[model samples]
Target: MMQSTTGELSLSWSQVAARRLVRHGLDTPAQGARPAEIVRALCGAHAQVVSAAFWSIGLRSASLTSTAVKDALWSEHSLIKTFGPRGTVHLLAAQDLPLWAGALSALPPSHNGQSQEVRLTPEQTDEVVKVIAAALSDTELTIDELSEAVIAATGSWAGELVMPAFNGMWPRWRMALAQAGICGALCFGPNRGSKVTYTNPRRFLPEFAPVEERRALTWLLKSYLSAYGPATPQHFAQWLNAPRSWAKELFNALSAELEPVKVNGSLAWVVAGDSTFPSSLPQSVRLLPYFDAYAVGGQPRELLFPGRATQRALTPSGQAGNYQVLLVDGIVAGVWHQRRSGRRLDITVEAFEQLSATQRRELDEQVERIGAFLNAQPCLTLGPVNVGAHA
Candidate 1:
């Protein structure tokens, strides 16, 4: 008998994808996992684009309706949309907001090196953060109203930054909004007619006490490995937008709980005892939305988006999400676009390689799944595809 001390497992990209897909609740029906579990698995969904957020969760939990996702954020108060990891708007479970806030707050302010034109001073930023929390405790207010409250609290200087912008003239306090969300001072409230609103996160998460900073962040790394494991500290650092040294510190602190694993000849870490792929795997085809967790969370993007898919999915600048992605046999195979008219949803696909007959049939089924998920008639336009184009 051979005793295994070093936890090293040889794994291929497909094997990783199979496990990751199931872990993300994409391999089964909606009942496969609850919304909170789904969000927890991928850390959180990139919800900067609300539609992408809906589809990200929609594609995973086929049974949950758009209305249900919104209800989860509003009526049920199960989901929270706020500025989370990487300093972007994300959707996470309300119960988990405190831990996210703790970890995010542990990092310094994001606007450290920003140009003075848009930067808020330390005192002004602190006042803005404090005012937002106080004004939103029980009442929901639009950004304008919140800005007013912040100005009242911090003086007119807080809103003095003026620039022609898409939304409106942004105030100096706007620069502190991301930090505010991270500090648990504010979370999205219901829409005030056409404007987005904010409220105290404690409204829905009153009992949510933030754990110790190190403990919460360490748990975050643990969860990161559960889904996107066999990934390097560099990957975790990039995902969280923290310093590489900071990430390494956290990994070092959690060394006892992580097992060494080899990913494409390089060393990475996975939570101990979970360094292998599943016993049985199912074939899969998926249409993932912009900044979808699967595409964002999976590591070794060079392997996940090989060859042609790489060029189109990622540009020379390295910015992704030029278009929606098409996943077949657990890899990104192409790109797609969709439009809606009345109750009908029209979709177009651009493939990187020649898809087989069975794959084509499966693509048709995907159309139906998306249709039911959106409560609309799905009409697909299929042809030989060239990855980046919308139609």
Candidate 2:
């Protein structure tokens, strides 16, 4: 139980964790919820690894297979694959793109350190974005095709081999790809053969139009708080990779819509009328994939990554989601990995401490759930995970 402070609702770490698990749809599977609903609930699912993104959604949904998730993205057009929070690839609900696009496009510009020769000026960046948007409108194009179109639309300057990529130098104008996505100019199309493609988001939601920035930010802040609340402005700032000052200002501007409360002596905020947390502690066990939103978005880091999880589960800088996590009773209790061979999936788990029989049984059930999501036979191994982060 939480010790109460005068005139304010007080919460315990356990209560917060339990409430978060419920809000995240992990405590009890949101039975019959569509993939888009799951994605919308989490704000977005990290999709740098497409498979990881599927599992992140699958785990929270009842009996949803990865095929359903793919269908939502490729066939039904219920989800949009694009740059989301922190300028990373994510699977966002198609219906919410207006809000996300507006909020993200409103972010203050960030500095990406590159030599002046390699970097695009603000004007050049705008020009490249306009060209890219024009090139992609109502049509899908591979990166190579888009690159050719961009250089032709702009000039030889846009084609200069400057930005360093893993293989070699990339063309200069390619730097604006994510920015174009942020501005509602483009989104991912289904891959053609082995090549990735980009297209205009308007093809999916023809009525799509970015909501006004202030209104969009208000919606985003409320959604973030609803899913991962009792979080401070710094947490919100870090999650969005936005300026802390800007986040503070936004939080202050919306003070009347928010309620302040103390969680174990630390201050945080929740939606004004939604500050109550569940009284009972949760006992759910889950296998969360890399960059899972629940693992990455939850705040008051020390509480989520208690003791050994700090050393094992999180990156040295304390970033979560670099490694796949094992959750017991709504908190990280171990780490795990999966490898697939033919129709078989092998999972290895490394617990910070021995799990009770019930926890072990629940862990087995969780592994089975993963297998069902992937349509593979599963084998569980209990041992040290020799693999490193994001292996």
Alpha-carbon TM-score of each model against the true structure: 0.92, 0.97
Alpha carbon lDDT at 238, candidate 1: 79
Per-residue lDDT tens digits for candidate 2, residues 144-230, read: 999999999889999999888899999999888889888888899989999999999988888989999999999999999999998
Off by over 4 Å in 2: 1-6, 115-117
Ten-residue region with minimum lDDT total, candidate 2: 1-10
RMSD of 2: 1.4
Candidate 1 per-residue lDDT over residues 1-391, each given as its tens digit:
1113454676656667778877887777566555666777788988888888888887787577777787777888888999988888899988788888887888745554667766777887788888899999999999888888889888888878653358677777788888889888898887888899999888888776667898788778888888887788898987887889888888898899888866555678889887668755567778888888888767787877888877777666555555689988668888888889999898988888888998888889888988987899999987644445321
Q: RMSD of model 1, in Å?
A: 2.8
For all candidates in order, the CA lDDT equals 0.79, 0.91
For all predictions, the C-alpha RMSD in Å is 2.8, 1.4
- The residue pairs in collision within model 1 are 351-385
Best by TM-score: 2
